[model samples]
Target: MSGSRKYVRHLSTLVTFSVATLVVAACAPTSAPSGAVAQNNHTDSVLTVGLPGSLSTLDVAHEAGILNYYVAQVSSEGLLGVDTEGKIVPALAEKWKTTDGRTWVFTLREGAKFQDGTQVTTDDVLFSLDIARDPERSPSTAVYWAEGTQVEKTGEREITITLPEPSVNFDWTVTASGGLWITSRAFYEAAQSYGSSSDLIMGTGPYRAVEFQADSHATFERVDTWWGKTNEKAPKKIEFDFFSDESTRLLAQQSGKLDISLQIPASQQPQYEALSNTQVTTVTDRSYVGLTFDTAVAPFDDIHVRRAIAYAVDRNSIVSSVLNGKGEVATSIESPEQLGSHIGVESARSLIAQNLADIQTASFDMEAARAELAQSVVPQGFSAELLYPTSIPELGTAALAIAENLKSLGIELTVTGKPVEQWITTLGTGEYGLSYMSYTPTTGDPAEITGWLLGESNPARYSQSDVRQLITEQAGEVDDAARATKILEATKIALNDVIYSPIWWGKNTTAFASRVLHPEINSYFFMSGWASQIGLTDSQN
Candidate 1:
């Protein structure tokens, strides 16, 4: 592991539902407004966005969802913010440095103030971090900060964090998406319930939340006193309206009621593209969707049984047909974009391809599946249940396909769907034999998702000392190339062990009205004030 200030900075930087019913209205073209009224509407400094899901809470620590993060980012901020290119940049903390990769020091920017007109002090930062790291307060995020880690104010405008061990990618843990959003301690302690509809969270971001209606909509207005550079073309007011139904969202887009719409279903991409005055953009995102097995279970505990199911499922067919050619078949759990963060993308791609070339990947073959099953302890058939969230219908479809394929090998697979909350609880309790896992990477670090899947706390209950050692080494390895190599090695081990079968990597499609200039849509864009990048087109302006 190389030790250098510039190298550390560079390395650190590198780190649904529904449908139907209203289809007829979605297909129908909306009536066009008069030219004069349209021009005025397009030029107005108000941006209305249609989100595919509802926001459950403004306090991401209480209940964190993609939508919740998206909304929280509008007004709140973290110590660091990820740029569109996935590099860690300054936010509340203007500058940061780590000499030994174990202890990090950050210098706060001058004149930073919260939305409530309170000066941001070192006490506020300490208080916020303490709350974020508390297990009871932030159950979903407390894992990022280990028990022995320590944080203290070293100066008036500087804070120091010492991790339990040397971690090259520890900086990512303080990012907005990484779950350490900062808030004023004064406002937080006074509020009866912070981040609620009545007492919305306060922060030092460019926007201030004015209204929040649970599972309905939220509104924000630009703050004139923000310390950071403000975009002249940024919208003065931004609104997020939740549309749980895809068709209804499509209808809203078609009717010109939304300036921007996100998470367009792959099946409805053509429909969204065909809409008038809309520009549809799609990109391969850093999200992993796959099948995980509870290795503690009898049949799944047998490696041969796991390999048999892996060989039987046709991943290519699922990506092409079920995903409508919107995504690619995943050969590994971590996304290529993440692994490529330290090195160039092309180099990382070649490295992964070359390293895993000799490993036996589970391809779709009935004979191979039968042979593997025959070698398992349960040579005969065994019945087990596979569970997925009801919100994601594609997972259910893919589960059915896998169940059908496994039938030929005397395996009786039962596919079941539960509500999102129930599905999460079921997974936490390890109540299912097999399950579907859909994870969105919070940081650019390659270890983010893999650390959870292959780490000691993995839900699969599968353990490999070699893989765990590699993961531990990579976390503290300062050299970019060395860290990437170790990650790939662990990936190979996990893939061969068949603890989790790779499915399809996801693609996100967002539609913007023609009058609105398209914003940079990337994996980390949502972690910052991304909407500020949206502006009126030349013609509209």
Candidate 2:
């Protein structure tokens, strides 16, 4: 949510809060065909997962929504994968080793074949990686982390990757991004359309695409011969039914139609928890929502003006009131779970602590905000527009709070709401005065956030030569301690510049009927490895 991927909003029909109480009739789960037998010794033949956002594309190359990544992970696979514990595990590649910082060797698992029955080859790996790195075809979000990486097939089962320069956590970069999903070149070349639910995407994952209806639902049948199979119960078929309306999704959950539901509303969490046959799982994530300042704009150009807004907004209050205490105060873009964010050596810890201290010590003082505003060029204070997506209720609440806070400092703030697409377009233009945005650290590495701030289209048009140099140096450095020091140093500079007004770190809440079991959900954006482990209890009611 924090890096380049933040701009990729879930495209859906905007549902207003006024209509949230009107629940659409819940749809019952469709029955599996008679031939669809339970796979991997599971009792249930189908797993019904309800999604609040619609899947934009099945093509991994052009996937934008975060849920689409989960669909890709279950239907396709990468050379590597992140497990629920946040460790890098084998997917397509059974094991890998690196002799030097620049070169890495990977060995594919034997007998592993795509859903289409074609044996996965070294050529497929190279083809997928090459396409991912091609900037013209894919967004920079997918390939920027692997900019100068080159791949060569050494043998039938082995491939070697050579980096232009050493990258500290290169494996993580590939596992976290979407475009790295290994696809069957033969099938893709012959197919009329890529990423369509209708198109058969041949992947080496646990599930195979059986049926796809655009913006409606997608059904996937389990592969009995999948290499990653475990003794745990595996759903024979997984169906992702898209219900953009939150009320409809909640109704589906309450009516026993949905096996799993994600992003449960804070207000409705208690209602679900009180139910006898339901369980809620929540995990604190690296994603943070913040107000970004566009420095190209007049008032935002002044450091004092930026710092004043940072001090004026109470992050803790937002977390408690707007988020219903479902989040934590975010001190910086890089969360504590990410590497180089107080997770390493003493020096790195000290640097991260300093940034947290800066955030903590700042208070919401009206007098202080007025003092800072007086020092700015526009002492009389000017009218400003605050933009945010109308779809997210918390964002609107935060914006209204910020507007009130700015008013106390003699700044007239005008809050405006736009659809996700329109809001993202305005953010990219760098023409906005003030706006709220978010970043979820997809890569467990901190460099993703630092490197993204330096991107041309970043909402915060902050350009400091020292910070940029440090980011570049840390990006290719293989030594963890060295990279941590550089990354933390850059973080301090960015915090001092007040590029982003830190808000709150959110927790991903997933709800499941009491019957749903064994699904391995992780902290990453995409809930990888979910399909193979989920199962239904004998008592479906």
Instruction: Give a tens-digit lDDT track for model 2, residues 1-541.
Output: 2221542321111100000011112122222222212222222557788865555556545543345555666777778766655556777877887755568788887888888777887887888777667655444345353456778898879988898776556666555342366878888777777667557567778888888876688888877657776324556778888775777877777766777786666666787676554577777655667777888888888978887788888888888988789887876655555544325434544656764576522467767787888999887888988776543556777888988988877889988876443454565457776767555555556565556655433557778888877876886776766777677678677777777776776766777666655634556525346565565544232
Q: What is the lDDT of candidate 1?
A: 0.70
What C-alpha lDDT do the candidate models reach, one value each?
0.70, 0.63
Clashing pairs in 1: 15-445
Which regions of candidate 1 deviate over 4 angstroms?
1-44, 358-361, 377-380, 410-422, 536-541
Total clashing residue pairs per candidate?
Answer: 1, 7
Worst 10 residues of 2 by lDDT: 12-21
TM-score of candidate 2 relative to the true fold: 0.83
**Tens-digit per-residue lDDT, 142-226, candidate 1:** 6667668899999989999998878888777787766588999988898888888899888888889899887688999888767
TM-score between model 1 and native: 0.87
TM-score on alpha carbons, each prediction? 0.87, 0.83
Best by TM-score: 1
Clashes of 2: 7
